[model samples]
Target: MTKLKGFGFKRYHLILLGFVTLASIATARIVQLHIYQHEFLSEQGDARSVRNIPISAHRGTITDRNGEPLAVSTPVVTLWANPKVLINQKSRWSELAKVLGESEKSLAERIEKNAQREFMYLERSMTPERGQAAQDLRIPGIHVREDFRRYYPAGEVTAHLVGITDIDEQGREGLELAYNEWLAGVPGKRQVLKNLRGDVIRDVQVLQNAKPGQSLALSIDLRLQYLAHRELRNALQEFKAKAGSLVIVDVKTGEILALVNHPTYNPNNRSTYSAEAIRNRALVDVFEPGSTVKPFTIAAALGTGRWQPQSTVDVGNGVMKVGRYTIRDVSRGGVLDLTNVLKKSSNVGVSKIALDIGAEPIYTMMQQVGFSTDTGLGFPGESLGYFPAYRRWGSAEIAAMSYGYGFSITAVQLAHAYAILGNNGQSSQLTFLQQEKQGPSIPIIEPDISHTVMEMLRSVVEDEGGGGVRARVPGYHVAGKSGTAKKQAASGGYTKDSYRSLFAGVGPVSEPRIAVAVVIDEPREGGFYGGVVAAPVFSRVMAGSLRLLNVRPDNLAQQVVKQGQVVRGGRS
Candidate 1:
């Protein structure tokens, strides 16, 4: 009986001993976690407790010289989703799809397809009004992140100049693409503590102040740009033209005042536009500059002492044969002086003078005038327009070139060349920014010769030069030339249905403050001559630009001259 009682006690004691051993092992693990592995466990805890949210950076604003906003940033919300959590939530998706302006099937498919990710963008760039609706709904597992979208306030008016950016806020065209590095700023970050509700209770900044991008101020006057836009658009539509472009520059400063290209795109929402609409036609498109280049040939002759403004050759019968092609004037062959050659736009007259200058010197003169070089306006796909090196020449090249068709040039290039004539023949650079101290430059063409050309240009606006007469403004003397080039087809035939009309000129001829160039491409299935289609547009723009610059009227000069003549008569 004693042994049985002792055995039972021993068995109970062994069981209690086993329980103590298990308790001791558990305490060892607790110590390891609290002491030896404390840091690792703490990091694990923090990983699940803390959250990272990115802070967005806004791109800088682009403004005109007058401080008018051409482009700006507006705060908006973008819808996002955690794909794994959002898929199969039909009701929530249905509501979201309605707000996002998408069908339910697309929303469901987008989420289902991207379920492999924790982060996914459901919709991009929704308007503030619509985003606010999604925000109010507050669907679980859905989020709205703060972001910015760039807006062009002027819309299509300055589209080709300011350019546009893509969905990721990367600049892709014009000044935006050219100065992208300077325009895109550094992004910043922040950290915060939130109670499971994802509501911030304690916020701490993780980075220094976000730097805003530097402002870009262009040389463009908004008013002049608007005026040019209106006139060019109207001309393009009226003439039923395929496309057109215009450029205005300050001769002294070499600053571009206004540049307009038709068939322009709106940068605001560029969803369905072609590359053509986005192209800066003034800088990109090159066309044969017919007849308009004749003056340069004459100017080069005068500069080189090969001829004077009075230099003349009989423009025989108004027709000269060149390689089976007869270069003829708009009129019958007739004898004319230098100014008469310009006024009548006699191809034969200019061709004879070009022959005297010789093709080599003429090409060199045009090259030095900037026609051989690109305007370098920083636009994408800018062309130097081919000017055939002096080494490449033929008999007909000079004759054909004198009246303007053998060489190709962009509208901006024409403006720069005319600018040289206006600036007393010191051809210089062209600038897009008003703050730029640089200018277009070339060797001076004896100021006297330039004055002679200036006076001749005045005759263009007066009664003698009929084409330029239409280009004249009421009070300002204008000097300019006209061009009408036959458009060649891609299939190797000249398109009788097409012509590139052009008007290149200088304004307020007394002081010569503005230089302008306009081109009309394939106008209205009707007569497409630079003088008839483009010069009228130039007249309107020059009038607006001169008015904007407050250039003193020549009317005052006329009064003073008349008064002086009267006093001189009395003194005599």
Candidate 2:
């Protein structure tokens, strides 16, 4: 009995030893995996399921000076699918195509064509509701991704100035392109766990945070923009003009209050965008300034100390000989003072004055007034119009330039020059951004000379038989110049019937607050004269802008007197 008992105990002990050995082996393997091989295994698993996805950042908002939103980014959705996985779910393609607004056969061909590509865009920039419908269909391998679409609230009214963006929300023109770097955002990275079918199962980690673009505040006023647009459109339709442009600048601050062009396109809807319609004509198109250059010519002559505002010149028979070309006035202003030379827009008188003062002084005055140079607005396609060097001027060239015929300038450039005149001959660098400080003012011309020229310009609007009488405002002292130039032909020389009608002016002459410029291209109705076609636009825009800004009417006394006279007449 003792021997049997010992044998049974030995058997039980052997069984217990075998069980301990197996447990020890299993524990050793587990330790090796958890400490030494763990990183490799985790990497292999991640390779199959983890993906680095790009996170889109929101584009910046563009606002006017008054905080009105001009451009904004609205949320949208994009539907994408993994072609390899999507090809297997062909049965659901018809339903998916219905939501995507594509035919089932087209969708099938697209999926087949990109079967090797793991991902393909099924639909881009769809509404949230459509995206949700696509998601609710719950087709395997199909997914929704968030994106943004650019929206323009002001539409075509501010199209040329504000500009437009592309499908990726990148600025393509105008202020948008000018400040693209400051307005574009940085995209981020994220790690997500995806299934074999390319469906995102869960988010693993936020690898990087997206930084949204900064907003831009422009100096443009929506009220003035609308007013300018309305008036310019009216003038274009009324005169049956081929094209037109209007620009309004704040005299004191050098801020562009309004810029509008005809044949404008809606930035919100670019289904039929064209290069011509998208062009900001006021800044991009250049033309001969014609009689608008008369003021500067008179100012240059005055600066020579040889001529006074009352100085008289003999415009013999309203015609003068300059080399082979003959300069003539529109009418016979046989003898006129310097002020009347501007008022009458005499091509003959101004040419004679320019020849007397010589070319260097005229060129110097032109340069000071920001001619033949960029306005420094940094706008894309902004032009620096052609102004020949003084060394190239002969008698004919001098005469042509004197009457504003030899050179070219954009509408904005003309407005800027007028602003300098209105601002007491101080040049403030032009900008589209609101002025943070007053900015350093550079003296461009003698303030007294500029004031004298301004005074002479007033006669052009206020006096009867003046060329710019159409520019007269009832309650303000309007000072301006009118110009009519034949358009240069593409081959050479000037076009016969095509003319550029221009008017540049400053309002409330006692305390100049705004400078306006209007250009009408090829007016086919009524008359093509600057006074008849372009001056009215400047007058209407200036009057509306002054009232909107609450500028105290400088002619309030005159208005009251006129009202009193009318009342008394009615009583009588």
Candidate 3:
């Protein structure tokens, strides 16, 4: 009894006192250290006891002007591992890999790498379904993290314009690559603290808030894009062409309504990738432009006071010897003036205009109309078309270039050049993204000349005997140019049978609003003439587009007009 009474203290009280005394001592030590060794304590805490907390933020959304989501973030799961903990559940390794779409060895390697690190990722972007399945399996040391994956709802139809992103969420192509800074938001960083067990303490100090990416509203219209894609795809199959491209832009706004290129790949599924198909041909490829360049040359000549739509030039039976090479027309000529020259796309008459204007003058006009210069469309890899400097050009070059032969132009350049006509001889930057509708464009060319060119182009569509009738809609007026250019062989000479058929136009002529360009590359078999191969496509596209755009039609006047009172065969 005396021995037991010696301590006179209960075990529970002693335990409590021990805790209280330890706390007091710890407090004293902290207070003393705060007075003397504050920096040292802070450094030690920073080394081991400190925690990191991450603040969540949203990625940007890419949408059409109508708020239709073109590119959006879909939730994904990232599988993480803690090697120390994972080792305890090694038995589940083989099973885990099957669910994760990875090899067991791959998973083992990921876990083993982090034997020292507290946490590491086994995989970065696993689909949500598989991640959830993994969680259900309840394998140890495994964690699923939430992340955003960019998804394109419109698929390949919009891929070339909207573009794709890498796994790290960087812009890769097209507009995405061009305006990356605007589209990408700042990533948030958080410092997280975990115990030795790697369990969250639930007391997190947020370091930085992630800035959400900006909302990108594109000018492209979804409906128009679909229509362009559908029509171009149909043309590819129907014509058995090597490839095709189409671009539609609003004349008033300069906004790109739609851009389509076939042999496209869906960004969502990368397995179908082909470099040839992935390119935005409308903006990237340049060609001699053939007869399509005729209108621009005519526009230039008219603006410079050298010619008029009613001006006459003898096209002499469609065959003429200029120097050594003979230039021939698809349709042999009559006494052609500006109108029939464009309608028949006559090389003979147009060459004469080019000669009048001088190759250098028309070449300068082409530059003014955006040839051989960037149009600043905000599309990745867009190129300025090729036109030789006046210093480098010869008289033969100038003569040949008059009818769209010596120089090359991209489809967009042709469209832009034609847009100057629609914009009343004003050239604005081509925009793939939408832009505010402008009032009237200041003249990039003489409006008087543009007016005549417009009139002549309208006649091209209205005249049934000429090549452009198929491009005419019954009620709406359309003005455009067509080209069937000789294709250069991969070897050296031009291919006798191969031709690049293209149509570039602007329409609802009464109140012209859109400038469209279609290029059917190597349409090799079906009709080689621009009117036959490209004009019908132009017809289907312009008609459907006008109807969709809600443009008013001038019906009775169009029907009552003299059926064949069309302007024919005139020089520029």
Candidates in order have lDDT scores of: 0.79, 0.88, 0.78
What is the C-alpha lDDT profile of model 3 across 182-246, one tens digit per residue? 77777666666656556554545567777877878888888888988998888878788998888
After superposition, the stretches of candidate 1 with alpha carbons farther than 4 Å from their true spots are 1-21, 103-106, 193-204, 436-444, 555-572
After the best TM-score superposition of candidate 1, give how far the Cα of residue 45 lies from its true spot, in angstroms. Answer: 3.3
lDDT string for model 2 (405-483, tens) is: 8788999999999999999999888878877667777898799999999999888887777887778777889799988
lDDT for each residue of candidate 1 in 1-572, tens digit (9 for 90 to 100): 99999999999999999999899899999999999999999888756655566677788888887888887878877877777666646678788889888899888888888888877887788787887898777765577777788899999999999988887677888888888887876666766665443445576557544566666888888899999999999998888999999999888878888899999987886763578788888888888888778777877778778787777678777888877778787765367878878877888888878877788878877787777586767667788888886666676777887787767888899898888889888766677776646544666566788889878767765653355666767677778887788998999857877888888899888888989999999996546877778877888899888988899767443322222231110000
Compute each candidate's TM-score over C-alphas.
Answer: 0.90, 0.91, 0.87
Q: Show where candidate 2 strays beyond 4 Å.
A: 1-37, 557-572
Provide the lDDT at 252 for model 1: 82
| Pairwise lDDT winner, candidates 1 and 2 | 2
Please state every model's RMSD to the true fold in angstroms.
5.7, 6.2, 6.5
